[model samples]
Target: GDSVTQTEGLVTLTEGLPVMLNCTYQTIYSNPFLFWYVHYLNESPRLLLKSSTDNKRTEHQGFHATLHKSSSSFHLQKSSAQLSDSALYYCALSDRTGNTRKLIFGLGTTLQVQP
Candidate 1:
């Protein structure tokens, strides 16, 4: 079965620093859309970045991630990560051109920024 895996379900942080969350996936499909969704306190998860083009990275807001079919990975990263970055980050996927199923997700990483 195709599935997404994210390393470290939680990450602790300082007021101003960098945060990197590992995201890997396994699927037989060659073309799958990878996405990063950010869920703030009370708000629903919102799209951060998404892409199906291999090696071509996708970025949104201040976050960036890329899809690597060869590595079967799409790790999210940011420079000088902020306190406001404290929230939930979910790595997701939507399969091939013919598949219309809803997206699937990794458990998510809860970023705790300490002021």
Candidate 2:
């Protein structure tokens, strides 16, 4: 079975500060795709970053994440946290079984950026 973990349930940060959302995963498959999805208020969840290749960093929408096979981690990071960045962040894992693929999501972390 594959699983993802987001250690923090809520993270509060000041605007202009660095942001880092811890994400780690465990999967029986050798190669797993990790993703970060952001869900803003009243909006559907959207993909922020995704990576299947280990040790490669992926970035989108001012956020970035790197998939590390050795540590089984895909932490999302941003150099600066903005008010607009406040949202619910989800860490997900995708693995294939036979011809079907399944996505597993973590408990999710809420980012609250203060002005």
Candidate 3:
């Protein structure tokens, strides 16, 4: 079985500080698309970054995450954090091992950015 893991439960950061959210995954398939989904206060969870290319970085909304197949990691990072960056981030893995694509999501991480 495939699974995604987010070790951090809550992440707090101040404005202008860098941000990092730990993420790791395991899968039975050789290639899998890893994704970062952001969920704001009331907004629907939307895909922020996604990539299947190992060692390549994917970025969106001022955030970036690189998928490292060798280490089985895709940690999300931001150079600087903003007040608007406060939200819940979910690390997800998607692969088509059967007839449909199955997505395994990690436990959500709550990020609070203080001014």
lDDT of 3 by residue, 1-115 (tens): 8899995788999999999999999998788888999999888999989975788888888999999999999999999999999999999998846667778999989999999
lDDT for predicted candidate 2 compared with the true structure: 0.89
Q: Residues 1-115, candidate 2: write the lDDT tens digits.
A: 6788896788999999999999999898877888899999899999888885778778887889899998999999999999999999999988754566578999999999999
Overall lDDT per candidate, in order of appearance = 0.84, 0.89, 0.90
- Scored by lDDT, the top model is 3
- Clash counts for all predictions: 1, 0, 0
Could you tell which candidate, 1 or 2, scores higher by lDDT? Answer: 2
How do the residues 9-113 of candidate 1 rate in per-residue lDDT, one tens digit apiece? 679978668778888988766678888888998898998888748999777777888888888899998876788888899988778677575688999999888
Instruction: Name model 1 segments beyond 4 Å from true.
Output: 99-101
What order do candidates take by lDDT, descending? 3, 2, 1
TM-score of each: 0.90, 0.93, 0.93
Better of 2 and 3 by lDDT: 3
| lDDT over C-alpha atoms for residue 82 of model 3 | 97
